[model samples]
Structures are given as structure tokens and as C-alpha cells.
Target: MIQVLFVVLFGAVAIWFAYKVFTTASMMRSALALLFSMTAVGAMFLALQAEFLGVLQIMMMASEMVVMALFMIMYMMNPGGLAAMEMTHQKRLSIAVAVVAGLLAVGAALFGGWPLATEAVAAPAGQTRELGLEIMERSMLVFETAGVTILVAMIATTALAIRRPA
Candidate 1:
């Protein structure tokens, strides 16, 4: 009962923060909202008894959010988020897309094929090894593709941000 309650609370918090992330006009505020949303997700994992994942999520998100905040401060005109402005484009279309996306996500959550844990839980070391194998084997291509994509994006961004002398 308590677990469910905590999970629901954190889920609500996450949703609220995520909404704020998109709704806020300030880049910095949006970044902070994203951080809060992810932290709430981590808290939900902890509530679900996924200690390793919870800690990893929180640590990774905290660092990533810091980096994002720094980037916004350096690159954005209004990183302090003091001025109110329209943050989104095509508001009606955006809301329509959001609704469709939300429905799809709910459908996936309800109907996705998830494997059941049939075997006994492994020891700590064994579990760590299993996680490594899963990441390195089953999800290797996805990870590698994401890494390459991120590398390319960073390079492109750096190039674009370089100031040319007049």
C-alpha cells in the first residue's frame, strides 16, 4: 500500500515537472523542471525497490542536468528566465501531438511485452555482470548509435557556436 502510494505520488510529481518543462518560457526554468521530473522518476524507481536503478538514475540525471543548465546559461539569451515569452509554436498542433503521444505511451505501457522473472535473483556481483552483459550484448547497437549521434551533435553544436573574427 505504501509502495503504491509513493509510486503514485512520485509519478504525479514527475508528470507535473515534465509539464512545467515544456510550459515554461525560460530555458533555465525548463532545464530545472526537466531535472525535477527525472529526479521524481528516480524516486519512483526507489519506491519500486529498484535501488541500483534509482541511484544510477539520480546520479546520471543530476550530472546531465548540470551540463544542460550550463549550456543554456552560455548559449541562451535569457538563461535567467526573468522574461515571460511564448515558449511553444503552433500551440494547437502541439497539444494535439502531445495528446496522441500520451495515448501511444499509455498503450505501450499497457500492452508492451515484458519478460517475467522466472529464475531466482542473482547475487550482487552476478547481477552486475548480468546488467553489463545486457547492456553490452542486447542493447549494444542502440547504445552505440546513441553515442555516435550524440558525438555528431556535440561536434556540430561546437562548430556552430564558434565565433568567427570579423
Candidate 2:
């Protein structure tokens, strides 16, 4: 019904944006396409009723993509990728790898021995809360590491932006 249609629409938009990501020569455009694709994926998660995941996906991807684009613009040889240059290397090999990966995913989808649900089961009242707690407890160190990494990156960016004496 509505859920299915929304999922399909989001999936299609994601795929289209993903295609645009690889096809564009402009680095900024590629980043934007990736952002759109990720946003569509977040929308898909929302349509699938995973509210926590949906919000997390959208927020995380948006920030990450913006930061990535900023770095590319600030540091790369071509700041804006305005010149006509090939963005990707080893085109044939990249295509082969992509094809193989797609085939593997399709194979897993078709043949993976996933169990079918025998009956409808209600979600727990505290399912999201419990899941959040479990993730935080198990990955507290990982989160701290990521936070430190981000802090370092921010410092580095700031330092690089500062004007140095000749």
C-alpha cells in the first residue's frame, strides 16, 4: 500500500542519485548526488518504520557529506573541479568490481536462507530505547574514538585555514 509505494519511490530515487554520483565529472556534483542518494535511503528507512534509523541516517549522512565536500574543495588541486578532468580511474576495473558486487548482492537476496516469519509479532514497548542502550554500551569506545577523530579533523582544518607569516 502506501508503505510499499513509498519504499519503491525512495529506492528508485536512491538508485538514480547513486548513478549520478559515479557519472558526474564535478566533484561537488558527485558529493551532492551522494547526499541525495543517502537522503533517499534515509527516507526508505522511515518508510520501513525504522524512525530511529531514518533520522540517524539522514542526519549523519548530511553532515558527513557536507564535511567531505568542504575538505575536497579546500584541499584538492582543483578546488571546485571546474576543469574537465576524469574523476575516476581504472574505469573498466571499477565497472567489473561494481558488477561483481551487484551480482553477489542479488545472489544473496535470492538464495540466502532467511527464515520466514510464521506469525505476526508485536514490537516491544521499549524496543528503541533498549536498542539504543545496547549500542551505546557496546560501542562507547568506538563513539569516543570517532569523537576524538572529528575533533582532530576540525583542528586540522582550522590550522590550515590560518594565515602563516612568510
Candidate 3:
């Protein structure tokens, strides 16, 4: 019963924030709405006992939204989106695509032959610890490469900022 309530709550929040993301005039607000939506999705994952996926969703969205905001600030004339502006393009086509996509999703959900787990599975002990160990063991090199790439990008950005206009 409590799980059902939480699922409903998180699902509603996700939908609300997703709507806010598209409807808001402010770019920052839109980005924040997207962040909130993603966080709510993470909450739903948690409610469904997908701890690793929940944490990953929240963390990934947080970083991505921060980077998106930074780029908006760097490139946009009105980073705050205080001035009213039409953010969307191709409204009619987008609506058409959205309608079709929504219908397809609903159809699949109704018609898909998904197998239900008959037996309750035991939860793993120290799931987080195990996940951390697995990630470190398999993806240490990937993380290192990503870190180096970020460092290089930061250096390049600093160099460009400091360069004098000829």
C-alpha cells in the first residue's frame, strides 16, 4: 500500500516537472524542471527497489543539468530566460510526433507480453558495496579517461577565455 502511494506520488511529480520543462519560458527554469523530473524518476526507481539505477539517474541528471546551465550561461544572451521568448520550434510537427509516440507507447504497454516474476527474490546484502566494487573493477579506465577529458576541456576553455582578441 505504501509502495503504491509512493509510486503514484513520484510518477505525478515526474509528469508535472516534465511538463514544466517544456512549458517554462526560462531556460534555467526549464533545466531545473528537467532535473526535478529526472530526480522524481530516480525516486520511482527507488520505490521499485532499483537502488543502483535510482542513484545513477539522480547523479547523472544532476551533473548533466549543471553542465547544460553552464553552457546556456556561456552562450545565450539571456541565460536566465527572464525575457519572454519562444523556446520551441516546429510546434505542429512536434505535436504530431508526440501524439503518435504516445499512442505507440500506450499500445505497447497494453499489448506487450511481459513475464511476471512468480517467486520473490532475496535482496542482495551490501548491494551498494557490491555495485561500487564491480564498477571500480570494470570501469576504472573509463572513469580515468573521462576525468582526463574533462580536465583538458577545462584547460582549453580557460585558455580561450584568457586569450586576447587580436
Candidate 4:
């Protein structure tokens, strides 16, 4: 009962944040809302006992997403301000196409049947901490590579965005 309630509440909050991310006029607000949504998703993963995935999601996706958004804002010279300029485009056909696509998707989902996996997806032997140790031991090179990649990407991104007169 409690778990279900938590799931429902968190799901609702995630949806709310997603809506804010899409409709909010402020770019910073949208970014913050996305962060909030991601945090909620991490919470959901934790509640489901996917502690490793939960932590990985936060570390690998949530933090990086926020950093990317911040860099984009900085590079565009927007700073902390939201872009309030209206985007002018043809919406009528797009709206119709989106509506039809949504309906088709819903209908397909309603009728589609997926076979359940016979074996339970196994959790790590000792949950998150044990998994972390295993990752450090066996996959240290992969982890270091990912970290180095992120560092290089951040430096390159910053260097490319900041122009100087020579």
C-alpha cells in the first residue's frame, strides 16, 4: 500500500515537472524542472530496489543533463534569463499529425501483448555498494574512460564557446 502510494505520488510529481519543462516560459525554470523530474525518477528507481541504476541515473544522466543545459544557456548569451521570444511556425498540420500519431500509439499499446520474462531480473548480490565495488574492480578501465571522456567534452565545449581576440 505504501509503496503504491509512493509510486503514485512520485509519478504525479514527475508528470508535473515534465509539463513545467515543456510549458514554462523561463529556460532556467525549465531546466530546474527537468532536474526535479529526474530526481523523482531516481527516487522511483530506489523505491523499486534498483539502487545501482538509481545512482547511475543520477550520476551519469541527471548531473550531465543539468551541466549541458547550463552550458547551452551560457553559450547562447542568455545567462540566467529565459528566452521569451515567440517561435513562429506552422502549427496546424503539425498538430494534426501529432494527434493522429498519439491516437495510433494509444490504440497499439491497448492491443499489444508482451510476453513476461520467466526469470526474475536478478538484483546485484549485495545491492548498490557491492555492485559499486564490483564495478571498480572489474570495470575500472571503462569507468576511467567514461570520466576522461566527460572531462574532455566539458573542456572542449567551454573552449569552443568562449571566443577571444588574438
Candidate 5:
């Protein structure tokens, strides 16, 4: 089915980003990887017919993530991009073992005979359009407020990250 294929593709991309996040050596790399992973999640939301949520994920999380990464990079004194620096103690073997164990556990749960929720309901036709209308009508203020907050946070972070003359 198309849905299954979309889910699989999106999941594979997310997993690749997760691998980059886990294996990267520094804050900027992890943040950049996390940004990609979040974008993949937003894409998955779109595939699942959650358009509002998908847009929110991109507008709120992805932009903030990039801003945070830039702030970190700007503030770092290393002069290098920080990707080459170690952010934590090396424990590759332990991390690999833990990742394998977690994967097995997730696989077991996924394959387990979990019953579908009978109470789940489908949205009516034109549901996304209706939802968008409602948001525009009633929740526009809240949405605008969130955007302002994101802008303020980005400005504050930039201000904080800038270096002062010695």
C-alpha cells in the first residue's frame, strides 16, 4: 500500500538521521542531525494526513533547531565548526550494545498482537480544509503568538552568542 511505503521511507530517513545524531562528536553536528530528524518526522505527519501538525512541526521545531545550532556554533570558541570536538566520553561498545537491545525490544513490541483501537474515528471529507479554516478563525492569535515567541527567542539567542571585544 502507498501508506505503508510512505511510512517505511520516512522511518528509514528518520533512522538515518538518528544514527547521525548518535554518532556525531559535537553539539553542532548533533543539533544539525536532530534538525533533519525533526523534519523527517514532520514529513511523516504529512504522510499521515496531519497537515496542521506537520506545518507546526516545521514552523516551530525545525526553525528553532536551526537557530539553536547556529547559536551554539557562534558561541563556541573552538574556531573550528565544533564537529571535530568530542562532546562526551567515548563508549562506542556500550552504546552499540544498548542500541541493539533497544531495537530488539521495539521489534518485539511492534510484532506483538496489539489490538487496534475500536474507538478511533476517521475525519470527515474536507477535514483538513475545515481544520485550517477553524484555526484561521479562532486560533490565529495563538499561532501568531507562537511565531513571535520563536522570533524573540532567536534574537535573544543571537545576542547571547555574540562575542564581546576583550
Candidate 6:
């Protein structure tokens, strides 16, 4: 089916980009790879018919990556890592850990006993609107706190950037 094909393609692309993110020497390339990997995850979500989550994933990652790149450009001497340098540390240990973690994740996915709805589900006319309402009603305080925290961090960053060298 088309859904299965899309899911497989997106999953492969996501894994490849994730690998590039960790292995690429260039920091900018790594960030871009991460962005692509996250986007691929959004595509997978779309394939699974989770439109809200898919769009959220894409938008959130795009903004987060932009902020990350700005910070890297502002602070890092060589944001691109053009010079020959080892990007990763503890190579063997990292590989071992990654393999073990991956296997554990696979095992959990294959064996996890997820609860299933007993009755047939009725499709909502406006799933996104319903989700938005639910989130606003249940988690508005958490969202407001996160927004305020981000605003404070932005103000702090602006102050630091404008500070004269002393």
C-alpha cells in the first residue's frame, strides 16, 4: 500500500539523516541533517494520518533548528567545522551504546502491550480544533510558562549581544 511505502521511505531517510547528524564533521551539516531527520519523522506522522502532530513536528523543528544555527553562528569560532577535526568523541563506546539502545528500542516496540480502544471510534469533524481546545484547556499554564521562559532567554541573549566588550 502507499501508506506502507511512504512509512518505509521516511523511516529510511530519517535513519540516514540521523546517522549523518552524528557522523558529519561539519556542525552546520549536522544541524541540517538533524532538521531533515526530524522532517522525515513528520512525514512518517503524516503517513500515519496524524496531521496535527506531523505539522507540529515540521514547524517546531524548523524553528528550533533556526535558533540553533543562530546560536552556533554567534558563539562558535568555526560553525561549519571546515578544518579537519574529529567531530565525535568515544567512538567505540558510542557505537556500542547506540547498538544496545537501538536493540532495546526495537524490543520494546515489538513486545510492548499497548491498550487498544474496545469500541469503534467516531471520526471528529475537526480533529485539529478539538486537539487545540483540549491542549488549551488542560495545559495552557504549561504553555504560558514555556513561552515566558523562551522570551526571557531571548531578552538575555539580546542583552549579551548588545553588551560592549570590556
Clashes of each: 0, 0, 0, 0, 0, 0
- Which pairs of residues have clashing backbones in candidate 3? none
- Cα lDDT tens digits, model 3, 1-166, are 9999999999999999999988877778878889899999999998887787798899998999989877776887776777777666999999999999999999999999889889754364567776677668988888889999999999999998896978
- Residue 134 shift from truth in candidate 3, angstroms: 7.0
Off by over 4 Å in 4: 76-84, 88-110, 117-166
Which regions in candidate 2 have their CA more than 4 angstroms from the true location?
A: 79-81, 118-125, 136-166
Ranking by TM-score: 6, 2, 3, 1, 4, 5
lDDT of 4 by residue, 1-166 (tens): 8878888888898889977886776677778888888888887887766877877776766777789678668765454555566543677887799789989998898888867677654565567666688679988899999999999999999999798998
All candidates' lDDT scores? 0.88, 0.87, 0.87, 0.77, 0.81, 0.85
Output the better candidate (2/6) by lDDT: 2
Candidate achieving the largest lDDT: 1
Candidate 2 similarity to native, TM-score? 0.74
* Residue-level lDDT tens digits of model 2 in 69-130: 89777776775667777656898998999899999999999999999877643354465776
**Model 2 lDDT at residue 58:** 99
Highest-scoring model, TM-score: 6
Q: What is residue 162's positional error in candidate 4, in angstroms?
A: 7.6
Each model's Cα RMSD: 3.5, 3.8, 3.9, 4.5, 5.7, 3.0
TM-score of each: 0.71, 0.74, 0.73, 0.61, 0.60, 0.77
Candidate 2 lDDT score relative to the true structure: 0.87
Evaluated at residue 4, the lDDT of candidate 6 is 95
